[model samples]
Target: MYDTILVATDGSDSANRAVEQALDLASMFDAELYGISVVDTRRYGDSMLSGSSGVIDDLSDRAEEVLAGLEAQADVGVTTTVRRGRPHEEIERYADTVDADLIVLGNRGLGASGEIGSTAERVVRYIDRPVLTA
Candidate 1:
């Protein structure tokens, strides 16, 4: 009983699984699918010592590439977005903006400490919407 489904992806193997599941669900429910890939710009903060020169531009380019690939892979029509910011924040904001009925994402690996992956965990914590992590 979903009208709009938001799928957050990072182009990782785990994310690909999430994408597949999202697509299937969208098709089954006859819901409009919205896809997004967020480029985490925080990792490339403006620090000369970090040597992250041009990192933002590079990430933007990569986001475009990832979104394009996702669009191509989805059999159903997908509205896709590429954003730059904290991954979870961007995903949550987009979901709210679209009033998505469900948010789908992958259990992309964990941080060094072995907790749930930061992005997925943050999305689950901050967004008061249904989340399906594959």
Candidate 2:
């Protein structure tokens, strides 16, 4: 029932599982698959020191690597994107832009485990589309 499926990844174990799930679903439905990795801008802050710190650059590089890994693991062609902003907001916006029929993401990403990651929780709460958390 899905046409375009958007999967958000953070290179975490759970995110990797989500990628596998999204890939399977996309293949099953013969749908387009899109992968996204967001560099959380909030983590770097807006201060001048933050800009000079190179943490954002590092994060961006990590995001790119995560997307690359996702693409490599997929048997089918995967459209990948890297964005900088709040993870949930960027994911939601990208999903809307792609007109995704399903949004798949990890329930807990690179953050501390025990509960759902804030970004995934927020995406589920704010995004209107169907979200599958792996």
Runs in model 2 with CA error above 4 Å? Answer: none
Candidate 1 per-residue lDDT over residues 1-134, each given as its tens digit: 99999998877777788889999999999999999988776765646426754776777787778778878887889998988878988998999999999999987732323456888888888899999988
Task: Give the Å error, residue 125, model 2.
Answer: 0.7
Scanning candidate 2 in windows of ten residues, the lowest lDDT window is 44-53
Clashes found in each candidate (C-alpha, N, C closer than 3 A): 0, 0
TM-score per candidate, chains pooled: 0.88, 0.94
Estimate, for each residue in 61-131, the C-alpha lDDT of model 2 and write its tens digit.
Answer: 99999999988888888999999889999998999999999999999988747899898899899999999
Model 1: residues with Cα > 4 Å off, grouped in runs: 48-53, 109-115
Candidate with top TM-score is 2
